[model samples]
Target: QYNCEKRQEVKHISARIINGNEALPKHWPWVVAIYDSNDTLVCGGALIHEEYVITAAHCFVNQDAHEFSVLLGTTLRTNSSQCNNTPKDCNIQKKTTRKTEVPSKEDEEYHKASETQVICVGVESICTPIQNTCCLFMKDIAVVKLKTKVNYTDYIQPIGLPKNCEDPPASSTSYSVGWGRIFEYYD
Candidate 1:
């Protein structure tokens, strides 16, 4: 019963994600699957509850702190080349040269790059020791905690995973806007 609903739901989400709506902004808050020097997608997770993100347990088995960086509010692909044709308001870039003297190290030239802000996960508790419980299998699923509560802005939001539905919807499409490698390979 639930399996059938999940499958349909997945299809619905997939279609909507691929064919987005005209009224929605492109950015989406999500977990970044940062692979190591060896280049492997270790695990997957979702950001839920302020100060914590959910991910797979195995994602932390043999990974380093530096190797992982979460890029939230992004689409599946990181690159924005294909999204170039998007509206001007969505992308505002200006090239100006300015200099500021720093008290500590050295002078620096500032190029004001106006990009959409980056939403970071706080990651409250990770790999915390816990005793096993019923109905909770230790699988590849964990949460990331954010340092601050995400502002409830129209431009940034968490992906909605509807409950009670057995499978993912096959029509209520959704998409993840990120600076990933979507355009480089797409036709």
Candidate 2:
């Protein structure tokens, strides 16, 4: 028997994250920490499918697909304590990037230049940004492909995507999360 209907619900009320807080284990299982080749935490992403992760396109700027890694099953971005209990290894199999044509000459030129400079996941297919418009200034979304099929666990899982084009009710709650320093500006 499955307990999906009566599980403890952990959710967010808005899309903005104010001061960082400790997330509980198995609470936000889809959340992941994106890292560069140097093992530096560069951004945050959510697992939306067994082989797909959604994150910001800006996160891959000046970065190569081979130089990226993702960490799951943990709350602290820089620590591996959560995965120590398990012996199985988790690996990222692939990454995908969708190119969108921006509106400004300056912005468009910059994006084109950057695309030439950095090689993102292979261009097997192209799609627009998650927003209704493909403007980079406002729409900064990307979907990354993982090479291996994800094995769901107590700390790692996939999130559900919207089924229709309609917007959510204004009363609905949304949550946004990321990995970063506690203070954005320090004197």
Candidate 3:
């Protein structure tokens, strides 16, 4: 069974930060990196269930399901090599310990003795919300089905969802974390 309540606390001071700081290992365990057929990082998603991920519909607007894959259990955005050449060739391995690569000297201090068990899986299908054609951003969410069910671990888990269709308190604060372009024309 999957546990959705298994999440680490996230602290945010302001509504937005110019460039966010690096998160701690396993801090956002449900986060996954979405890659294109060329194994290039396209977007970031969250594991909502054992076999499902929630990402933006715009990320796959005209893309095929076979052209995408999800990488789980790593903090490095450039960890596509861990997925091997293709998603089909990637297999779920037993818990194995391996040192996570730290790209820069600054990141080394944040990831001392860090380890990660990366899993790469192909997308079986994508489910998008039905909406009018007038607006492109309307109902821009998508649910992606994974080719294989993920085995949960300390570094891999599902995120919790709201039980009722109720709005959050007016005083509530929310935070979003992902790897993406800093500005519209940056990347």
Worst 10 residues of 3 by lDDT: 89-98
Runs in model 2 deviating more than 4 A are 1-16, 79-135, 183-185
| Per-residue lDDT over 68-122 for candidate 3, one digit per residue giving the tens place of the 0 to 100 score | 8788877676545564334463332222334333446755754443444677888
List the candidate 1 regions with Cα displacement exceeding 4 Å: 1-45, 62-69, 76-114, 127-138, 164-166, 169-187
Q: What is the per-residue lDDT of model 1 for residues 23-109, given as tens digits with 9 covering 90 to 100? A: 112323333433332333344455454344566555555543434434344323222222222322221122123321122222111
TM-score to native of every candidate shown: 0.40, 0.62, 0.77
Name the weakest run of 10 consecutive residues (lDDT summed) in model 2: 117-126
Clash number for every model? Answer: 51, 4, 0
Candidate 3 C-alpha error for residue 125, in Å: 0.4
Residue 54: error of model 2 in Å? 0.4
Please identify which of the two predictions, 1 or 2, would achieve the higher TM-score against the true structure.
2
Off by over 4 Å in 3: 1-3, 9-15, 84-115, 181-187
Q: Candidate 1: minimum summed lDDT over ten consecutive residues — where?
A: 105-114
User: Which residue pairs overlap in candidate 3's backbone?
Assistant: none
Best by TM-score: 3
